[model samples]
Every structure is written in structure tokens, then in C-alpha cells.
Target: MLIPSELVLSILSYCDGSTLATCQQVCRHWQTLIDHYDALVWSPCCERDFQKGLRRRFWSLDFPDPQMVDAAMLSSYAKPSTLWQSLYRITKHWSLGQCTTSFLTNYTLRQQKRRPCVVVGTTQEYNFFTSLSVAQSGHIVRSNPMYKGTTEGRQAMIVHASFDQDPTLSSFYLEDDALHGIVCHYSHPASPWIVTGGLDGTVSLWNEPERCVARTWQGHRGRVLCVSMNDQVVISGGSDSMIRVWDLDDAEQRGSIDISSYLSERHDWFQGVGEIALNGHLIVCAPDTSGPVLIFSLLTGSLVYELKTEPQDVAFTRLCLTPFYLLTKGEINPSNRNQVPIYPNTSSSSTPTVSSSPYSNTTNSGSSSLSSLSSLSSSTSTAISTYALAPPPSLSLTPYQLSRYYNLSSNNMTTFTAARSCIDVWDLQTGKLVYRLVPPLPATTTASITDIRISPNAAHVFACVEIRDNGSRRNELCYWDFSNHHTAAPSIMVLPSMTSSSFGNAWACFY
Candidate 1:
């Protein structure tokens, strides 16, 4: 005799999360009831678990409230039961340090006309890419190292592939021989536009759908170091210590800012624009490794603010800017507090180019050593003051409300840490330390982070980490999921060809 579906669901509803999971595997009838009516069965389970102890203390303000989602704003995008269940599972997995990894693909060097240098112990071979971009659709595009050529041709190329698949050899090449090679590039997350900055100081926009150059512009007197763009504007920082703004539509020059003029002294020939982040309105630029980051108005080409970092934490190679906060990766000095000092340009009118650095360039008072971490922790850190940058009208919230909405308390500040293997999140509104995120790695191995990328909502952070274990080195692509997206898939399919090396020798890791 079989039990009635209603009666079975009622009985299952009384069960805990673990018991409910077990019931689904007992028989097809129970599985059907549970899977079809997941909302009814799992919603309560998630709430119960979350209330008891599954809260993530990340910077997000939407904690303990099972109804509010910090990542996706659309209610139609995620079903209630599914979202709750996914949240429960992901939180449990992250907190308990549980995840499965698999090797995807590795790169090999092809035979070249010039003598090739032999690579040793996965260090040089694995660090092949200089810059990479990821889209919302899971497509990853990588700019190749600026070298002479492969067997293909003298011009440099950019490789495109999906996150789960191997990179295809078919790529867009910089055809102009005058532009010695490609240095940096940016790809729109949703659109078909791709912009590349070349050694010859040329920026070319490529239309992926048409697979041809849409437009080109040349202004930089030296090699372009970094490039970033939106749909309307393209910003390029070059080795000439000049940052140029271009209109994406007609390829006309919008404005230019010389980095050297603002600095205290002249920069070395090797020290040029190293990183740039653009959001159409503002351009955050770093000229050299150690930085007093300069912010420029994209439209007027005038200096807006100057952000100074402690000497220990000023080796700025990466820059990510949101509407309110600026994130840079550098050497981390872990102290009781990890606050970023923001200095407003008090002399913007009288001396627009003068740096407003708080600390003297000679004094290293802020320098501190990094502490070791056995596991991820939410321990508190230092504090700083917040600047009132208005939240976008789209959010429809004031700076105070925005801070409270994001659970930033009353500090109105944001804080971040830059340990090699760890990343931190700050509340720009409150000027307080929010979250310190570290990827789950084995306690026995030593790991170093190569790159870190944060989603626009600050809900997800992706880390590309290389770990050394028992004399062998391997890479891992790890992400911290704060949203209830399509995480619980039926099964994972590993590509057969992805297991083998396409170029020379391959190294692979699970996603």
C-alpha cells in the first residue's frame, strides 16, 4: 500500500534538511512529491537552517532574511523554493569547506622560428596570460603574452573560450604590423564589442558577430598598457604616462590626462600606466606599481580626487571601480585594522595636478607584515572615514539608507585586505571593514592568488589561485557564491578533449 501524496508531504515537512534529503532517495513516489513540491518542502528547511546558524557575515546587509536576495533583484528570475534550497546548500558547502574540483585544460607552447626558452615547474608556463575578462554568459577571453610570434604569424592574438570548454585556436589577431603586438584588451560582458590596445599605441574595436575591425584610433606615443570600456566610451592608459578617452561610436578623442604632471617627480621610462578602470563617468588610473591612485573626470579631463595607499599596500597592478568604491590589489599588511585612507582633492581648483597624499613619500609608517591564516575568519579589522558619493538614482536610496540597506551600520566607510591568497570587502558608505574572503584551500599546501575579479553587485568574487603541493604546482578557479543561482545541477559533464593538452603540456583544475 502507498501513502497519499498530501500525507507524505505533511510527514516530510516535519523532517529536517538532512532527513528531507534522505526521503527523496528512498523511492520514486517520495522523490516525485519532494521534487515537484520543492517550495513546500525545502522552503521551511532553509529558513530553519538559516535561522539556527547558516548566516554568512559577508558585507551584504541582507542577512538572516531569507526573503531578500542581494544579488539578483528580479523576483521572476528565481523560484522561491529553489532559491532557498540553493542558498542553504551553498552556505553549508562554503561554511563546511566542501567542494569538488576537476582539471579543465592546460597550455603548451608550439614550435617557433626563434629559439624557445624552456619552462620549468609550472611557474612560467602557467602564468602565460597577462589579462583576462569574463562575461555574464560564462565566456572567458584572454590576451596572450606580448611576444614575437607563434607558428601562426608575427601579430599577437586573443583567445576566446567558455569556462567549461578548452580554448579554441580561432582568435582575433592584431593585423597591423606597425602595432608591434597586443598589450591589453577589454570585452563587453553582454555585447559583441572587443577593444584591444597594442604596442604601437593603437586601439582597435572588434565586432565579434561580424568578426572584423569596427574602428581604430591612434594617439598614445608609447605602448598601451591597460584598456577598459563601456558601451559608450573607451579608456586606454599607455606607457607614455598619458590616459586617453575615446568615444566608442565615432572613435573621436574625448580627452586626455598626463599622469606624470600630477606626480611628485618624473617617472622612470618603465613606469607608465599599469592599470585602469572606467565606468563612463570616472577613470581610476595607476601609473606604476606603487601608487597614489589618481581619479580623473572622463568628460572634462580634470582631476577629481587622489587616493593614497600605504607604502606596503601600494603596489597597484589591478583596479576595479564601482559606482561608489575603488578596489585595488597590492601587497597586504595585516594589522588589527585594514582601512583605506581617502584624501579629497582640497586643491583641485588651485593645483589640479598636485598630489594630495596624506603621508610623506619617504615615511613608511603604514607598513606592516602579513599574518598567516589557517582558515577563513570574520575577525574585525581597522576603520576609516567615508566620503558621501551619491548612490545612483536607479537604486533610489540615499547614502545613509544605502549603507543601512547593505548592512554597513553607521560607519559609512568600506575596508578591504590584499593578502596574496585572501580578498576583503568594504562598505564604502560606512567606512568599516565588512568581509574578509579567502578561498578554501587545503591547510597543508601553500597557495598564491594570481587574479581576483568581483561581480558588479559585489555578491560574487572569483579567485584564480595556484597551489604548491608535494613539489607539484596546480591552479584552481574558485568562487564564493552569495547568490542562489542555478547551482544545483543534475550532473556535470567534463569535456573529453579538455583533458589533453592542446599546445605543449597542460595543467587543469576543477571549477
Candidate 2:
């Protein structure tokens, strides 16, 4: 019986790595079938490939997985010298790597180390936005403004900063003024929105998405960290260990739940809502509380499944509901805030406090298929592979466990720690820790990470920039774009390493 490739892919859920290798070899038709069904690939594979890139592991190899180190297609991965081979084609984190046509002999060692970046349409790269809040007034609230680089001795910039639009109106106003950005919500009844939990402790929301915040709540004693938005519901978590859900659809605090109360009941030191994962009508909030991620019917707002996290003490950072697995971000300390995670300090990173919760593997068929190919193909470039001095013992992490963790923290911190980074990514399908996307810093490691933001487009891409030490880097917005060539990391070719935030959320209205 001849099975159609598309039909085969249609029925079976693809896991990454070996699963994909097996499926693709079924027949030429299978290969062509899955090629078009790349969405079937697990989300974690993307995270893994990106991690390979940060560690410079992917540069010299064909596959992102270390298992491919001596595979039959080693030549197919990288030809001759490791510096110039590519097994997969990607359009993110736009950086200048190697060229097979020109001989390295023609250039000096320094030239080889130099990353090739050219200015394209825009030049203002600022920071990675943790929770991208587009206020109606064009004011932007940046989580942290820390950037590392040539400015090492300067004051540690706040990981949270606000961009001003108009003090009056509240709305996600798309305007074109040089000094203003979308900041607040419009007080008008027509449109209402609210921004909660930033690098700061403030929690506020407006009645309209295009209007100013009509109410601001300051119940949490700590910084309001992460935020989630759905129909008319806005959920926020913070260092205070509280998960408060606000019904924005109504003009009142229609419904609310306290994560702190649950934490106090459990007698845990850090029992609060660190992050929230949302699916259609279901909501799962990760907390220090001992249970599977707290799941509830998002619309009904009632308790649902409490899947045990298993024996591992893994806390989720990010979660999404779709064809992908129930995803979660890696566990990082709330205070572990250097703001920029360009690379994993595998050598010195502390072993995460193992959780008593049992973690169910989240990898599924759809996400695994895509996850396999990307994971098999990408790694970090040559320049990032080796370093003269490893980070201090306090910051080092083991390379072997790179694929084991996922971090939901931002990579754009504004501190002076050498080991901390701002960027972290995860596989949305399998809940596997894939990679850490660190902002590209200079040789001196001067600027710390500031804020981070991912492209809202179809492509899963994000960007990070260093803080502005002087007035050198300003007038900014976001980093990646899917507009042309369907490329991520568009700023890698068009702007400096850091991005600017002079514009609002879409960053369309540049200052």
C-alpha cells in the first residue's frame, strides 16, 4: 500500500530529532510533504537551534544537536573547514558569518572575527521589551534600560523605564511625533486598556486598548513582572508572589484571585505567580505553590487540571496553547537580574533548586517535526564559539546541560554582572529548554542587556539591544521583521547591535 507523504504527515504527530529523521526517510514524497508542513515541527527545536547559535556550537556543524557531531552528513553540514558550512537556511538574528567563495587567506584573523553588519532602513536599536505595552498615548514603558558595552563604569540603568507620549489621552495611538511614543491608555469609554506588572511594581489598566489607564492597582509589594492579555481579561504576576486576574471587559474588578494566599497556605518562601500560560479558555499560572501549573478555565475562571510537575523542581517561564505542547519557560531567579543573557554561563550557573513537582514531558507530534529539522541544522557562529577567559566560577554553566533548561527572564538587563544575560527562549511544543538568545555585545562586554521584544509577525523572531550609555544610541523601536525576504533579525543587517525605542509598540512611529 502506498502512503501519501502529506497523508502520512497528516495523521502522525512528529517528535524532534530521531522522529523527524525517520519520517523524512519514509519516501521522497514524505520529504516533500513535511517540507510544506514545517509547522508540524515542535517549537522547542527552534529554541534549541537558537541556543546552539548562542554557544557557537552550530557555526562549525551542520546539525544543532551534538549527536550529529560525527553523523554521516558531516561534510554536508560544514565543508572543508568548519567556518563555512550550513545545513539549514534561517533568516533570524541577522549576523554576518562566513563566505565560501572568498578564501580566508585573503583576510586577516581580525577581519574574520569582525561581524559583518550593514545599516538598512533604520538605525535605532534599543532593548528587548519583556512585556511589550503599547499605550494609547504613544508612551512606552521599558522593563529595564540596562545595556552593557564600552560604558562599564556608568550607573546601572533601570531595567524599567517609561517612554512618554501624551500625559492626557489613553490609547494605543499610532502617531508621528518626534518626542512622543505610545505610553498611556485613553480615558474615553470607547477604547480601554491597562498595563500591569512591568520591571516596576505598578499595575494599571485602561478601559480601552487605545485609551489611557483609568485605574492603577498597587497591591503587590514587589515589581509587577509579567503580563497576559485576552478578550477583556488582563492577568499579571510579580515578585510579590501574587497572581491577580482583572476583568477589563467590565468597568470593575469583576474577578480576582491571589497567588499569595495560595503561597502562604503552602508556607513556601517564593510562592507567587512568576508567569502565566494561556490556552483558548484555559489559564495556567506557574507559582512557587506545589502543584502542576495551576490550570483553570480562563473564561469560567475555575480550577481545572493540576498536572503534577514530576520529581524535577522545574518552574515554567512561558506557556502557549495551540498545535504546540503546553510550553513553559526555564526557571531563573527573580533577582538574577544582570538583564542581558547573550550566552549561557554554563560553566558557572547555579544548579536550579530541584522542584519536588513532577514535570510531564510536553513535546507532541506537530511541534516535534519542525523542532527536529531546525535543531538538526543550526548552531552559534565561529567568533562566539571560544573565549579566552571563561566567566567566574559563580557564573559558569556546564555545556552538556545546555539543552536541558528554558529561561523566561528578559535578556536586556541594565546591570554589571558578567554572567547574567537578558535573552532566553523555549520550545513551545515540548516545553523543552532550547536556547538562550543573548544580545550581541562588544569584546569588552561593556553594555548590559536592557529590554527584549519578539516580532509579532508570523515568524518566531525577537531582538535585544544594549542600554544607551551616552546619547550615542537613541531613537529606537524593535529589532526583527518579516516584511522582506521573510527574515528574522532584520536589525542585524540594518541597525547597530542595540535597538531604539523612540517609536511605540509596532515601533512604526519613530521619534
Q: Give TM per candidate.
A: 0.53, 0.39
* Candidate with best lDDT: 1
Candidate 2: list runs displaced more than 4 Å. 1-28, 35-227, 236-243, 248-254, 259-437, 457-488, 491-511
Question: Relative to the true structure, how large is the alpha-carbon lDDT of every model?
Answer: 0.48, 0.34
- Residues 1-511, candidate 2: write the lDDT tens digits: 8976556765544344336555667777765554555545423443343323322211111223323222222232233232111222221221111111100111112211111111111122243322333333233322223332124322111111122222343222322111111221111111235443434455566443332345555555666656666546666676676666666655444455565543324333344565575433556676643334666555555655454332234333334332122433222233433332323232332211112101113223333222233323323232232111111211112221221222212343322133333334433322333334333344443332233332221122233233333433332322322112222122121111224453221232120
Best by TM-score: 1
Reference-based lDDT, residue 57, model 1: 37
Q: lDDT per residue, candidate 1, 305-402, as tens digits?
A: 67654443234445665433455543333442245322111122311111221111211223111111111112211221221111111111223323
